[model samples]
Target: MRLINLKPSRTNQLILALLPFLALLLAYALGSTARLAENPSDKLLPALSSIADAVNRLAFVPDPRTGEYLLWSDTLASLGRLCSALGISTLIALVFGMVVGMFPYARALLAPFFAAVSMVPPLALLPILFIVMGLGETSKITLIVIGVAPIMIRDLALKVMELPREQTVKAETLGGNSWQIALRVVLPQILPRLLTCLRLQLGPAWLFLIAAEAISADSGLGYRIFLVRRYLSMDVIFPYVIWITLLAVLTNVLIDLVRIRVFPWSELDKAS
Candidate 1:
């Protein structure tokens, strides 16, 4: 039987867009049941509601210690460390991936190795990475690189090489040199797709940063999670989980702005 291609219906469109919301709703419902299973007396919604009130105590309620509200400093410090690791990931991914993608032989040699390595849990390498780089900024930043760079470089390289050969031949025929062909023609075509790649990579890189910080750092979001566990402070760590998600959203939106600006042609095609 032959399958016919058709556009999505209104219901499908609505469901696709609302999919994440639906899944989260389902998860929360199931999670609430699971919590009740663990301890029947602990009603999930009321407990969450109580925690919400307690968070307000940071400003509204007085602290028992100095009679002042407990303002959070750990959150800010954790965010700073996250930003540092993220910065390292972006720079390394772009430079390393860009070069590898543009060169065929280099891509051939390194692409498979990277793909295989990426499949291995990046966290699994933390012990060795720590041993080699130490438990300072080096180990954490190095972990981010190992996690992000391989995939980024591979995608960027493939996208660059994916340009229509006819365009390259056309440019060469018009007296454009190798460098000129790459810069004027190849760069623009690939840059749009690369922007998409960059946006996608940002989330994963930041995710890895959290684990990297958690494993060894004395500070950062990961460190705060550890501290919270030590103190049985669940609420403090939970809010930062929300913060990480919000940061990813904001970063993706920023990249989306660049996509609109730098790749008007791609946007136009998408519109069509």
Candidate 2:
């Protein structure tokens, strides 16, 4: 069979999906063993046992000073900022995307501006945000919004513009006004794409959030990682990084599920 036509069975697919992760774990274990054998005081590539201990301390044990589980607290703080910023970004994208996609004059005025804005690196604006908004949750959340919103806006706008022109014409033929057509037609068609855009932006959104948190924040996964780095706490840092990855993966999965549940027709559209 040609490579293009070859497909794995479900069991083979599952095994293939797991192979890379298993290899990664095995490599880390071997590296850690070798490093520790050479130098028992090695701080890098900590053994899995040490990582487990750190996870227990961070996730299960409460801090002596703060009396709160560090991992859970950090997760909450990071997620609060992430969700708030993404929510704001989604609203902004939906409104502006629709306006730009549906109205030529609005598109002429705003599309180029947003397209340029999206090109600017979000991290470069971190200092400005901190100086202007101050080193608070607001600045962190704003950084994430600034990083992800413009791209999302552009993506959603393109999706809206790509929608079949015939749908709008049919709506107009039914005597639907501009507002009616937008409300009944454009919004529904672009919502699935909106979710997809949000999904695509999640990684950048997390990057911006972590950058902001590392630079200025009292509590967050990023802050904790940076705080511990002074002492070369690889065990803690490693688990925190893994925890962040797991969270992002969970979020991506949840978003896909919600999209499938809410917009089953989008899947059918894709199949066709």
Candidate 3:
């Protein structure tokens, strides 16, 4: 039973492609077991079946009435907010990270601040941002940016510092001045790792999204989650989870697709 020896192949890839769906199935199985443990007389299996059925129903094209079903507008709205926030944070992270990371003194001065702020919890910023920026889209975007950028800065800075010294030296020797070496040579080498960090930040982005939307709005998956919690409805909970899970999967796939496009070398290396 040497699972570690199992190398990935086309079959593995296809199976792994279904892995997220498989996980949902497994979650359902475990949920039923937990329900049975809690109550011997409870109809756990039937409840699980109903939840699965409701998931399919709600997934259909929701009608014009807002609360009639899980409207696609809400999903798009949530995703749009995420994109705005994540986009700004990514750019800020890349620029500030590369610039400050290249300089030892800057890293010393700023890295501690970045690390400290990250520990404060992005939810703590929600009230202030909501007041200052209001319950507007700006507040939501800022929430995600605050949550995501610190980790980005930390990872990006570390990766930049970890880059091979020979690249820097060679650039300098080739008449590439300070700015030229960092912008032209160093950045290209580090962009792949930066992309990886951005991908990793998506989970935190979701957390911040909840914080942002929990305050105001009738729509979005996070708000829907809250609505279900009010009634203690596990069936309703499943739909929101499915929505988020699908979105996360799609976002990661899109990012990876773009990553492969931008750096085809990574794919080549993987194949080799």
Task: Say which candidate scores most in TM-score.
Answer: 2
Q: Clashing residue pairs in candidate 3, if any?
A: none
Residue range 1-272, candidate 1, lDDT tens digits: 33566667999999898999889867866776678668866633324544566567654577676575433544465556556766665566555565566666867887788778767777889899989988887777777767776677678767766777788789989999866876787777776776787777787777777777777775566676766677555555555566667778897898889888978899998789
Error of 2 at 79 (Å): 0.1
Task: Give lDDT tens digits, candidate 3, residues 72-165.
Answer: 6668788889988888998988987897779888888898889898787788888888899988788888989988998898888888887788
Rank order by lDDT, top first?
2, 3, 1
Reference-based TM-score, model 2: 0.98
Q: On lDDT, who's better, 2 or 3? A: 2
| C-alpha local distance difference test of each model | 0.70, 0.94, 0.80
**What is the Å distance of residue 23 in model 3 from its true position?**
8.5
Q: Which has the higher lDDT value, candidate number 1 or candidate number 3? A: 3
Segments of candidate 3 deviating more than 4 angstroms: 1-64, 67-69, 267-272
TM-score of each: 0.72, 0.98, 0.80
Better of 1 and 3 by TM-score: 3
C-alpha lDDT (0 to 100) for residue 119 of candidate 2: 97
